[model samples]
Target chain A: MNTNLYDYAYELEKAMRSSDEFKHLQEMYKSVTNDSEASQMFDEFRNVQMQLQQKQMQGYDITEDEVMRAQEIANRAQENEKVTMLMEAEQRMSMTITELNKIIMKPLDDLYGSMA
Target chain B: MNTNLYDYAYELEKAMRSSDEFKHLQEMYKSVTNDSEASQMFDEFRNVQMQLQQKQMQGYDITEDEVMRAQEIANRAQENEKVTMLMEAEQRMSMTITELNKIIMKPLDDLYGSMA
Candidate 1:
């Protein structure tokens, strides 16, 4: 088989690393980490978020109280300047990834539509 | 800003193209296209699937009858040898893309914990 696909994968990886969104994400990450309070808040928020996801993925029902608490923590974290910046950067990176996925999957999409 | 992310995206595209799953998908696509009957069946299947997706995306509820009809078409299409090969190939390709997406999104995953 040809090595073209692997080569493209490597190139795509490089591009993602150099993208503005990724760079901004890294920068915001450093900024947030430099602030002890912001870092702690972000960490707590992340923990709560992960637990919720794990529960959902495991097919466990999350209580309304748990959901509310998680949202509250996220809201508090967002109030922090560093956390807000980090989130925006993260969103940009996410959008970039979504766009790239669409481009990369075009062939499959054209051939199979949304069936896959 | 750095261009790393875009570069990575390109590399990833290359890798996906060169992957066995992708190559097989292409080959299967070619085989199905060469057979008129299979190609027609596949085209119809794709059309139905796309229509359903569009409706769902538009927030329209798909009636039970529509769902059953779509499933029937899919079942009939799968019975064709060429269509079956194409579907299998597509499944492999979809799996490969999913895996690649996971790998590419690791950093974001760790940082945001699925919040993004």
Candidate 2:
């Protein structure tokens, strides 16, 4: 079995899931629900989640129901553009990580397959 | 009628959900499901998504099923650490957006509540 990819993925997944950045984001998102400000903040988080999910789904098979849900979620975070902008910025950073991972992996696959 | 908070939240949520960064992440995530390289990439995505969801869920009411789901998803992307890393990176980016939203909203809440 090609445990190479499987093992590599597992370790990487562990690192990502455990990273401080990931943990922090989790904390921040939860923070949104803690107080009045927090609830407002959560509204912002929900906005970004909805926006990213919607746009990324552009030519994909996302259902109408999903789109509606996204809209409903977005409506909850509408009052502050500043908060919305901040949320957008963070989402971009997360997307960059995805790009970075792919960039690193292509060569390794070539290297491993050659050895195999 | 303290929709000041509710309205504000709705708009911010809309913005976050609609932002370019959010859209981009969705696109990148879906890209992983398109081909072999993409699948390897997807496993990485699963890792980050799992990590973010799990970590963000800290002190929250996440269930065992969700944790198991996250781990299972992480395993799929184990073939490529690079992909896993990228996925993690993207998730962090998404999470930062949440933080930024909170920062921007707190003051607004204070100002609005005072007005009321």
Candidate 2 residue lDDT tens string, B22-83? 45544554454445675655745555576766555442455688767767766666556545
In terms of docking quality, model 2 is incorrect
The 10 consecutive residues of candidate 1 chain B with the worst lDDT sum are B1-10
Local lDDT at A104 for model 2: 35
Model 1 spans with C-alpha error above 4 angstroms = A114-116, B1-23, B26-84, B98-116
lDDT of 1 by residue, A37-86 (tens): 99999999989998988776555678999999999999999999999998
Model 1, span B1-116: residue lDDT tens: 34555555655655665577877888888899889899888988988999998876555678999999999999989889999999898777767666667656666666555333
Candidate 2 versus the native: TM-score? 0.30
What are the chain A TM-scores of the candidates, in order? 0.92, 0.47
TM-score of candidate 1 on Cα atoms, chains taken together: 0.65
For all candidates in order, the CA lDDT equals 0.77, 0.49
Clash totals in order: 40, 47
Q: Each candidate's chain B TM-score?
A: 0.89, 0.46
